[model samples]
Each structure stands twice: as structure tokens, then as C-alpha cells.
Target: MAETEPNPLLRYLVSDPDAFAHNLAKAFEQAGKAAAAYLKPRETGDTDFGSTDEITRITKTLAHVGEWWLADPARTIEAQKRLVGGWMDLMSSTLKRLSGEPFEPTIRPDPKDKRFQDSEWNDNAFFDFVKQFYLLTSRWAGDMVEEAGDLDSHTRAKADFYVRQILAALSPSNFLMTNPELLRETLTSSGENLVRGMKMFAEDIAAGGGDLKIRQSDYSKFRIGENLAMTPGKVIWQNDVCQIIQYAPTTETVRRRPLLIVPPWINKFYILDLNPEKSFIRWAVSQGLTVFVISWVNPDQRQAEKSFEHYMKEGILTAVEVVEKSTGERGVDTIGYCVGGTLLGVTLAWCAATGDDRIKSATLFTTQVDFTHAGELKVFVDEEQISSLENQMSLRGFLEGRSMSTAFNLLRSNDLIWPYFINNYLKGKEPFPFDLLYWNSDSTRMPAANHSYYLRNCYLENNLTRGRLELGGVKLDLGKVTVPIYNLAAREDHIAPALSVFEGSRYFGGPVQYVLAGSGHIAGVINPVGKPKYQYWTGGPPQGSFTDWLAAASETPGSWWPHWHAWLTDLAPEMVPARQPGGGVLEPIEDAPGSYVRAKA
Candidate 1:
């Protein structure tokens, strides 16, 4: 018999004992630093790393599922048998493959699931078995939650979300020995990858001030006013809550009515003006519209007492006044994105109630006034969870920006969290500079009062569309706002589900042209006309269920910006000479993208 070749992994491990030992020691040292950083005392306002509230909540949710399943002996037996049967079939397939026979996998991951994308996961029998095993167990766990008939809708949703999170955390792809690519890298590099990765891990912990501030992009490469929010404009006015940015018109002539944009304070407004190429602000200005955006302040303890009413009064209401003053336009066309859109709706209602008709036409992007169909975000808005969050906020005077950032990341863990985790901590690579990811990492804090009111009134009670919401001693009635409305909902928005937005269109007492854009919340709204990568759908009035409306809607391939522009022009057809930023009554306070946006959380 021919002598068997030595295993490359073992050969490499022992080939240079001294070098390998040195690298191993260095890796251990870096890992110790990382451990030390993680165990260090947290700063003031920092969240407790070992907080048991969430763990207890998850445990109770899982227990509810277990109780339902175990209540009946038949159900328990059926669950066990199904799981065992899957494992048995998987084992049989592995055995056949080992015996030099071709065999099909017992189960496969969802095609969209990128976690098992490595070719070796299928070609190698061991990894193949591991992938199938995890898929089978995860699918079984999901089925168990779905089949639990007694769990309430909220509990069931919580259980499903938590279980998926737990499964994602335990994926074999996350570990070195289990992940084929990681194992290959370890052997080929003699564990040098781990040394570099551990060093980065420790540095990141320190950067986060005892929290894991995973770097999504090379943040150093991007700056707010220079590379990121470089739109030519002037900060004409500002109050405590926000600064209003009036963009200089690119066109020789502009619309009679200026446009005021209300972006969500959850993030910076530069998402609209990421760069000249992708900027909605630039595009709108070039389309002969005077554009003004409210750049919300990155609030701290000083703004902690600011409430939802304060945001409406000092933020949107003040911006409207400034835009009218600057452009000398009595009425303005207003656009709102996400939570900002929700606030816009409330403002419209309040304006109507107070007989203030400054807003002529209203456009909402991926905004949810009706939270009945609000997606997974509702999972984090229960009374218990909100109370816990409030307690944390009370101690800090504001919710830590990372806390919200982590929740948003968890919503799409595989895409957002895990990819970076693997690349940064496993492959030991720095992420490429991406403007969107950089903007994503630039988070903003939520003032305690403002955040609490938003949670309880919007997500928790669904009061905005129900005519139950009150602000500034005025009962807000969406039905009273009779402005021509353009409601745009993204087809795949997790933050504000299309169905939720669709349901909201009916609450407004006005003609609503409901359009559904392809892609998610960010991509759908930020789609520039020049690129036209996605499509938008249009139909008659938003009537009946979102599904029926979608079926009858006509699909147009390209950006929704032009379509929106056409609608906007039709509403206010008169043209006037272009208005320069701060060219009117309101003098320039500062440059565009404002100092408020520059103040980091």
C-alpha cells in the first residue's frame, strides 16, 4: 500500500514550532486584552452588560412555547419524533456518502440564507452534516412556535424573534472549528488571522467605551460636511431641537412653493444627502424645487425633558415657519421619512385643527401612522420592555445611541451584524469604506421624554391614526387634514411595513396617491433618478387590503423620484425665480448639514 500523505493542518502546525508558538502566544495576549476590555467598568449612562431583563423575557417566551408543546403528550411525542427523524435521515445520508455512495441531503438551508454559502459546506461531508443539522433544528424550533396554538400573537412573535436570534447566534458559521473557511484560514495562516482579529476586537471594545462597537466601515475615511453631507446649502435657522437647512437651488428657476423635509431623528439627515451622486436633496434642488431639511440635534441630558409635543412645536413647526420666512412662500410642500413622516402627519392634523394652512401638499415615505401591521419593531415595544427602557433612560437622561443601533442591527442580524462579525473578528479584515454603512454607524441619542412618548403613543397604543393622539393641548384628527397626499411605502420595509403604510393612507381625509417602491426603507426612498436601479408601483386610491391594491397596481421600472416630482408639480404648477439659501429674511446661521448634525452622540 502507498504511504498516506501527512495532513496539511498537522504538518503546518509542527513545521515551524517556534513561529507557531510565538503567534499563539500573541493571539492569547490579544484575547486577554479583549477580555479585560469587556470586563472593565462601564461608563456613566452605559448599559449593564449582564442585564437579566432581556434574558428573562426570552426565557419566559421560550417557556411559553414549551408549555404549550408539552401540555399534550401527543404533541410532545410528535415534536420529538419529527426532530429525531430528521437527524436519522441526515445521519443515513452522511453514512452513505462516507461509504463512497452519492446521497442527497436530508435538508438544505433557504436559498436566500447566505450563512451556508461556502461550497465546502456541501462538498465536505462533515460540514454538510453540520449545516443540515442546524437547519433542521432551527426549522423545527420555528415550527414549534408556529404550531403553539395557545400563545398570544405578541408572545408568539416574541418567541419566534428570540428563537431566530438564538439560532443565528449558535450558527456553526460563527465558530472557527465548525466554519470550514475559518478552519482553512487558521491552518493556512498558522493562526495569525486570530492574532490580528483579537487585537481588533480589543481595540473595538475600547472604542465603544466597554461596549462592542463593531466597525461596519472605515469610518475614518468619511467626514460629515466634506465627503458625506456635502450638499451646498446654509443653516438658516435653529432652535433647541433642530436646525433647518435651506439648500441652494441648482436650477435657474424654482417652484413657487418650497419643499421642507422632515427626516427621522433616529438617524442623521445626511442619509438623503450622502453625496452629490445619491443625494435626494441635490436631485430635488436640480428639479427646480427650493429644498429645506430639518437637521435634528443629537440630543443629550439637556434635551432629556423634550417630549413629543416639544419635537412637534420646536422641530417641525419651527422649521415650517423658517422655510416660509426664507422663501417668502406662504405654503410649502412637505416630505417626511420614517418616524419623521409620522410626526409630519401629526403636524398636518394639528395645523388643520389650528387653522394654519401653511402646508399645501404632504408626502410621506415609508411612514406608519397605523401600527396595526407594524412589523418586528413591535416586539421591542411591550409595556414591560418599554418600562425597562424607560428606567435605563431615566438613569442616563437619554437612551444610548448604541442601544437603538443594536436593536436595528438585530432586526437583520445575518446581513448587518454577522457579516461584520465574521469579517472583522474571524477573517481579520477591515471593512471597506461605504458611505451608507458609515452613516449607519453614526447614531443619535433619543431624549428620554421624546422617546417614551413615541413608544407609548405610536408603537405601543397605535394612537396616531386612531384619532386618539393629542399634542400641544390639541386633539390631532388626521381626518381634518385635507391637503393632497402622496403616500409612498417600500415593498420590503421592515421598519415601516408597506401594509402598515397602506392601512394608514385611509385615515387621512384627502386624496391619497399610494405608491409602493421596490427595495427596503433606505434603498427605496434614497433611490436617485440618475441610477434608477429599482421600480415603483402606482394605482388608484389606496383602497382595500395592501395585497389587492398591489395586484391591480401598474409597475413602472425606474426611480420614484420623477413620479413624485410630477405629482408635486401638478399640485403647485406656478414657477418663480430660484431662491438662494438665506437669500430672504432668515440670514445664514452656518453652512449646510449644520453644527447640530456634526455633534456626535
Candidate 2:
């Protein structure tokens, strides 16, 4: 057994336990002081927990809950009936299976659900019983919540989320005893797997965080710019905020209108250029389009003042200038993804308002200009949470990647968090070498000012969609963006839900072409023409509601990438001889996926 490197944060604390205890004590003290202040009277009177009004309030709450159940007697009765019926069905199914008689399951797991994909679960009576029991239990919990109709919506949602967490925590897959496969493995391995699992658990805890990075199986396989981001290109322009990369041409003739990609600063740019097989940039270049991507700087304390405006001027606008200079072309086709799309939308509106027509056509990939329904991520954007985040960011001058990653992983705990816990810690099995998972673990820090401003303005207030968002001393109006716009959304995206992404189609004052890709946030955008896994949908025009559009749309058999290229090429200028990399006045500064991207906060 080899010892791995300890986390820097925990290494110091582990070496000096007394210092760690002191720090922990100080934290508790501060917490106590804050709690005391909150509970204490303004005039310095001693705090009293058992007041008449407080007791009366508690009694009233209990009375209200009782009244709610009593008043909805029929609903409660119906809920009980459903639960009984479910149990009966489960029992009947189990008996039939035990008797070797064919029985149809009352509740079947979704075909697309990967969790219960094992054929053994369906083939074996015991595994099927476990799965059925789990499903029934989950349904009963949901029903319990539904029966409590008297609770406020917020309280109900919180309860539901917590219940999901509880259920996920208690999943049979997490334990060797309940999980038949793991139990078999334990017996087969002579408990060596369990021993290895224990070692892994201790190693994870000592590292300060239990969240694993690279899979144990792929510990030494992948590296940036080697197995990943292997595209041939050069950084034609670099600034304090970002580096602009001009990808080398693959085709003899290129479209005069170059494509400029602005990926979210929340992650690296290599997501679109991961490998030769899946690189969207390589595909675009192969399509006879000169492509360029913006590699955002991983900001630190010194770059704390970098605001939304700083991203526009130094990030998007700078890239535009560099692209134009390199190709000797006035207009460039722009693609903004996620946060980058949000930034690009603001820049386009700013450009339209200021009469600066740099962008020929706009393409937004899973980008949300309107954050009114920004999905589950919105839960952590309230004033209280924002204030707490601001306090932490103020201390460090930037939000750490780990904090951000935790929040994101919470969005899909069953898929992202618990499975890893089972695989890495409980089962002690190494994770498969997944390229996307590697990219997902690779995160970046957000500057205090920029992040706070974004959370408050875009998420909390949703000012961007309302035409109230002011950037660079200019109020942005998304409707002013009249260029041919294409909006791409993922059907199964959690971060930027497809419907939320669809809303952008209505904001653009142009010929809007909205395409719904298959898969979630990353896989949807990265879906190639070759992948037979998923399909896409494209509707008539952005005329009615998203649901209506979805209903009216035609399903495409493969990737939406080709469809996007067709729409872009239709709006683009005539083709010309390929432009040499770094052929313009702005000379090449470094290589593509530049030094800024490799920097950790």
C-alpha cells in the first residue's frame, strides 16, 4: 500500500492538532456570539426562550397541522389507501416471483435510469424484491409529503429535498449487507475489497475532503494538453482576464465568418475540445470554419476587482478584436456557452445599445440570459446565502472551487455524490476512466466582486432578462440583439434547464432558431454525429410556449451540431482560402488552451 499526498489545508492542521483545536474553538466562539446577539433583546435584556407568545405560536403551529390533516380527512384516507395498495402489490409480485410465476411489476424503473440497469436485479427474485422495496419506500415518502398539503410550498420543497437526501443516503447500493452483488464480492475477495475500502476511506478523510478527484483506476492516465485538449492551435491574444486561441485550419477553404467560442469561466474551455474524437472545435474546423475559443483566467486575490464589465471588455470584446484582426474580417460568428453565453448576451446587448456591430450572428449553448427559473442552483442564491458566500469570498478574495463543486454536486446527489461515495469509499472499487468526469472535477475559482455581482444581479434579481441590468455604464436590452440568433438547449440539463434556455429564443430580436439537444448540460452540447445514444428536437419558429414548441417540433435522429452548422453557414459570408494561424497584426502569444487555463486559484 502506497501513501498518497495529503491535502495542504489538512496537512498543516494534522501536523499541529492544537492549532486545529484552537481554530475550531474560535469558530464555535464566534458562532455562539452571533447566536447570542440574534437571540438577545436590543436593549440588553437577558434572553428568555419560554415566552408566552412563543409557546402560543408553537401551540398554534401544532393545532394548524392537526387541523390540516383533519380538514383533509379524505386526502389522508386516500394516501393511506394508496400506501396499502402499493404494499399489497409488492407482496403479490414478490410471491409470484418466488413461486416461479411471471408477474408484471406495478412500478417499473425508468428505462433511461442507469441505477437499476443490472439484468441480475430483474432476473433474480431476491434482488428484484430489494429494488421493489426501495421503489415502494421512495413512493411512500413522496406520498407522505403530498398528504401534508397544509405545509407551505417552501417547507414542502425543503421536506421533499431532505427526504430525497435521506433515501439516497440509505440506498442499498451504499452498503455491502443490503447489496447482493457487494455481498458476493466481499465473500469472493476474502474481505480484501472491504479492507481496501477502509484504507481508501481513511485516506479520503485525512485529505480534508471525502470527494474524490481522479478515479483510482485512472490515477496516472490523463493529463491536460496530452490525452485531453490535444487540438493544434495557438494563443493569438492574451490579457489579464483571458487568452484568445486561434485553432489551426483543417480545411483548405474556410468561411470568411470565423466562429468564436466563449465557454463559461466556471470551467475550462477544453470541454469543447476534450479529444480528437469528441472535440467540437475540431469538428467546426473540419467543416471549413476558422474557429477561436476564449480561455478565461482562473482569478485570484489580486484579480478580485474583475467584475462583469471586466469580463466583457477584457474577455469577449478583446477576443472579438483579436479575431477580426487575425482574419481581416469585420464580423465573426459568436457562440457563448452557459455563463459565457450570459456574458455574451450582455455584450451583444451592450454592442447593440452602443451601436457596435462586431458580432455577425449569435449562438447561445445552454446559456441563460433570464435567470428567473435558473433551476436548482437558485436555492443557494438568496440574500442570506449570498451574504454568507460574500463573507467567505471577502476573506479569500475569491470563492474556492471546492465550495462551488459541492453546491453543484448537491443538485444531483444520487448521480454525482452518493454513487462516488459507494464506488470510491464503500465498495473500494476504482472508477472507470471517464473523460467527462475528469473535466467535471476540474473547476475554477470565482472572484468575489464578479461572483457576488453575478449572483445578486442575474440570479437573485434576474435583472438581465428584465432589461434592467447595467454593464459598462450601459443598460442592456436583449431585444436589441437583432443578429441571426441560434439557441441550443439540452433536453435533460439540470444547471440550465431546457425550458429556461428556450426562453432566450423569445428575447432575441432576430430570426431565432432554437434546437433542443439530447442529454444533460455537457453531453448535450458535446453530442457528436456519431453517437447513437440520443436524439434532438427542432421546432417550427419561436412563436408559442416552450411546451408548445416541443410538441410541434420534429425529432432529429442524431446530434444537433450539424443542424447548428447549417443555420450558421446560412447566415455566414462566402468562403475563402484558409487564414494562417496568427496571420494578423496580433502575434501569437502562447499555445491554445493557454497557461491561464492551467492555473489553479
> lDDT of all predictions, in order shown?
0.90, 0.77
lDDT of 1: 0.90
For TM-score, the strongest prediction is 1
Writing each residue's lDDT as its tens digit, candidate 1 over 1-601 gives 9999765345224345576678889999998998778777554435476468889999998999999889999999999999999899999999999999988889888899988888889877788889999999999999999999988899999999999899999999999888988877776777788888889999998878787899999988998999989989999998889999998888888989999999999999999999989999989999999999999999999999999889989998888888878877789899999999999998999999999998999999999888999988888989999999999899879998888898999999999988889889888889999999999989999999999999999999989788899887889999988999999999999999999899999999989999999999999998898888899999899999878999999999999999999999999789999888876677898898889998877
Model 2 over residues 340-452: C-alpha lDDT tens digits? 99989899999999999979888999999887667778756666668877877887689877677767777888788877777775566777888877777777999898899
Query: In model 1, which runs have C-alpha deviations exceeding 4 angstroms?
Result: 1-17, 43-47
